[model samples]
Target chain A: MPERGLLIVLSGPSGVGKGTVRKAIFESPDNDFEYSVSMTTRQKRPGEVEGVDYYYRTREEFEALIAEGKMLEYAEYVGNYYGTPLDYVNQTLDEGKDVFLEIEVQGAKKVKEQVPDGVFIFLTPPDLTELKSRIVGRGTDQLDVIEKRMEIAKKEIEMMTLYDYAVVNDSVPLAVEKIKQIIKSEHLRVDRVIDSYLKMLKEL
Target chain B: MPERGLLIVLSGPSGVGKGTVRKAIFESPDNDFEYSVSMTTRQKRPGEVEGVDYYYRTREEFEALIAEGKMLEYAEYVGNYYGTPLDYVNQTLDEGKDVFLEIEVQGAKKVKEQVPDGVFIFLTPPDLTELKSRIVGRGTDQLDVIEKRMEIAKKEIEMMTLYDYAVVNDSVPLAVEKIKQIIKSEHLRVDRVIDSYLKMLKEL
Candidate 1:
């Protein structure tokens, strides 16, 4: 059987541009990994293509998958169920193709509990101040709400300790470049590739 | 003090083209790391420049440095002492510049003992047959010598388990690319870059 592929997770504090960077990586022509399209029970937005943006599922269908233990990680947001499908991820990985997941910090933590070996990357802002400005720039929140978000963002930044990498999203291309390098290097990591050499040595 | 730079070591079995890959890397204008030129007690060879090729030293001077614990790792071969100078490596790394070392397996092991956190990369031949062919292609060894060299190569290949990455020397360019990725990713590892984020969080 071909070697299993990496489960690469990109996640971090809110407004860290994790989605932008993940989109940039996928938009790149040389991307070889499969994007793990999420499943959600929410209504589809305008121009959102099925299986492209998300796999829109009925509430019953989503809950059934969750009950069957087929959701890699799932979370309810405003009564909408959103999650990665365990079956899709495992099938793609089993086929020797990497599965990319751009998730929230809490969802990433759940993924970590289930797949400890996944390459968990934390895309951080240049600093806390930059993160605050990004959140403030959203302009939809009141001052108190922004402060509350800054507090939550501070807590999420602390979760960087749980990740395998902390990439500063100073620029989309630069962050994408670093993430690509991380994936390439992870494939060459000894723990992941040494078994073949060990077997080769035994044969020799 | 600035963050300490990574100690990147490239090593592998004999005739695995470690020197070729290293030369390719250094020749690239984008290469950022400093190559740790070795110091040796051997007589200067024809057309070999001191410091660029090696830091030529007398036996007495080499011994003096060794006695003073100035060598990062050293070995004796053909009545000559060859070793990496400890001061230069530490000084470069202290200045927040990476130091790259391309050495043999034994010297790599010694460097590992001293710098366990260093990024150690083992370059392996595609397979035993390819390794044997490469050794035989040297055209200087008798059958018995070739056999003995193969045995030694086998043992060195087994030492790959000690490394952080194993790069197959299938093609020099491919191997160089992988090494470049490894270095880039190594710089992003959480353990290496997390301190700054932790400090940022504390201030926040």
Candidate 2:
């Protein structure tokens, strides 16, 4: 049997540097994993590509996939449908490629329900004070939005208990290394390895 | 608040290099975590220290701890009691140190029940043929004992589904690196870091 691939879910509060860590993991030469490019109904920006950035789709097509249960998990944000395509993820794993899904807490929960054995990783900032500073440093949002995001971040923090593991994204390289380790370690699970051996022994 | 340490449980079939991987983790300069030395009624062999290798205890003492529910889990092996001491693990975590327990599948399961949030990692061999070779290559066991161990190993493999993560010990150094990464990543759990910040904001 072909070696099975792992479904790794990455979630963290805003300003935890998950995006930077994901980029690092992708850039690593040692990693051969595939990042799941999600499909969305939102219009692509000037620099975005259809498949690379996202599988940009019409609202009708997005809703149809959801209706057919083809989407692993989807959410409507500002009237745009954003979701993971189940077929693409399954196809990647079938090819013995690990799949990485960077998602929010709600989407992660949904993915877990559908794929019970998927690895769920929660990323966090080094500490609260540092997180607040990072958020303030971004200078993107209005003061009111930053305050709201922080409030929502609190609720998300409580959900960490639900994750399979938590990785602190204190440094980008360190966080990426941790993600690689988790994936490598997960490949050693006996459930997938020992069965073949037992069968071989019986044949012997 | 002091960062909380994770309760990590590592288990796998024999010959999967779980011990070697753990040794690598301990040897690494980045890992300051404490390994939980088990308490046992088994007689200490040559070169084994009481507190360092294991908490060597009398049968009566072992029974006393088990009766008081102080032992996290225990089992009788070769007429000797083998189990984990609860206080040391808790004390280590309370001091902001991660605790690692090298246990068998049964003991790992029991620890998981008691510590629901404990990280359960199962070490696996690269393949069945490699596993068989490793078991036979050990050269310490008699043919019969090796056969029985192999049989038991098969049974243990079936329990892999109970574990939270599977790490294959293909190479000792690589396996250890993966484990270290898992530990580092877990520290960044969003709930802990984000909640700390939210609490700080509330105080303000």
Q: Which is the leading candidate under TM-score?
A: 1
lDDT of 1: 0.88
Local accuracy by lDDT, each model: 0.88, 0.78
- Tens digit of per-residue lDDT, candidate 1, span A30-102: 9999999999999999999999999999999999999999999999999999999999999999999999999
What is the number of backbone collisions in each predicted candidate, taken in the order shown? 0, 8
Model 1, first chain, TM-score of 0.85
Interface RMSD of each: 3.4, 5.0
All candidates' chain B TM-scores are 0.86, 0.82
The Cα error of candidate 2 at residue A86, in Å, is 3.5
Q: Candidate 2's residue-wise lDDT over A147-177, tens digit each?
A: 7757665665566767867776667887787
Top candidate (DockQ): 1
Count of clashes in candidate 1: 0
Cand. 2 Cα-lDDT: 0.78
lDDT of 2 by residue, B112-141 (tens): 899987778878767644656656767777
Candidate 1 has a DockQ of: 0.48
